[model samples]
Target: MKVKVKVVLKDGILDPQGKAVLHAINDLKFKGVGDVRIGKYIELTFDSLDQSLVENETKEICQKLLANPVIENFDYEIEELT
Candidate 1:
């Protein structure tokens, strides 16, 4: 099984890194760039092929360490690999 996790800052939260990325893009003459929100992407390999169990564990991992529930939110997808 494989799980993909994406962690991003919640709405109304200030993201200096995202802002910096936007500014840099504009400075480089890239036009029409809208609000940029930076996030973290993580991949995990699991021994079980059970989708439900893997998703549950992934959520737990995110809540405990991968993300800050107070200021950040996360979503994950689980896939079984043969």
Candidate 2:
């Protein structure tokens, strides 16, 4: 099984890195950009094909280690590789 986790800043939180990237993009003449936010992407491969267990473990990992509960929120998806 393949798993993907995305961690992003909560709404109303400032994102300096995303802002900096946006400013740089604008400086290079990119247009129609409104806003940007930065976050983390995590990929995991599990040998088992049990989607429910994988999902539960992934959620636990996100809450315990992958994402900061205070400032960030996380979501995950699971896919069968083969």
Candidate 3:
């Protein structure tokens, strides 16, 4: 089983890194670009096929170590590849 986790800032949160990238993009002559936000992607692989257990464990991982729930939001997907 493979799990993919995405952690990103909430809609109302200001992202300085994203802003810097946006500025660079403008400086590079890209037009019509509005706001930019940055996020993280984490991939996990396991030998179990139990989706419920995986989801629970993944949520625990997020709450404990993966993301700061106060300012960031996270979601995950599980896939079984045999």
Which number leads on TM-score?
2
User: How big is the positional error of residue 47 in model 1, measured in Å on the Cα after superposition?
Assistant: 0.9
lDDT of 3 by residue, 8-73 (tens): 998999999999999999999999899899999999897778888888899999989999989999
Among all windows of ten consecutive residues in candidate 2, which has the lowest summed lDDT?
A: 44-53
**TM-scores of all models?**
0.91, 0.94, 0.90
The residue pairs found clashing in candidate 2 are none
By lDDT rank, best first, the candidates go: 2, 3, 1
lDDT of 2 at 36: 88
Q: Report the C-alpha lDDT of model 2 over 1-82, residue by residue, as the tens digit.
A: 9999999999989999999999998998989888989999999898989889998899999999999999999998898897
Quick one: how many clashes does candidate 2 have?
0
Q: All candidates' lDDT scores?
A: 0.91, 0.93, 0.93
Against the hidden true structure, what lDDT does model 1 obtain?
0.91
Error of 1 at 55 (Å): 1.5
RMSD, one per candidate, in order: 1.1, 0.8, 1.1
Candidate 3 Cα deviation (angstroms), residue 53: 1.1
